[model samples]
Target: MFPYAAELIAYAAGAALLTAVGGRGLLLISGLGVAATLGVVGPLLARALRGAAAAPQPAPALT
Candidate 1:
């Protein structure tokens, strides 16, 4: 959840900055920021999810 939220916030901020700047250089900068955010967040999210899935579970008792 944190990763997803962070990704969303980063993307929104990047978009807003790009719109406000309205220039080729800023566009490139904003694009790099977005890509970097995703590059970091994506692996963290994947690892967290994988860890959750790998957690131990108790076995069911038979009657």
Candidate 2:
């Protein structure tokens, strides 16, 4: 999946979850959403950072 898409999904999911949980204020909900988003996206980001940092390969020559 696309990295940015995954991050967006995570954030939306968090906000929805918080909404269901019934927070007292928008600030609190927003804060929790951020934490939740980070929790999910953090691993994906870490994995990418740990992976190879190689440059993109060039296209193959025509036969």
* Residue lDDT tens for model 1, 1-63: 999999999889867877887678687886898999999999999999999999999899999
**Per-residue lDDT of model 2, residues 1-63, tens digit only:** 699999999889868866776656656877888999999999999889767466576899999
Each prediction's RMSD to truth: 7.0, 8.6
RMSD of 2: 8.6
Report lDDT per candidate.
0.89, 0.81
lDDT for predicted candidate 2 compared with the true structure: 0.81
Query: Clashes in model 1: which pairs?
Result: none
In angstroms, the error of model 2 at 59 is 15
Stretches of candidate 1 off by over 4 Å are 1-22, 58-63
Highest-scoring model, lDDT:
1
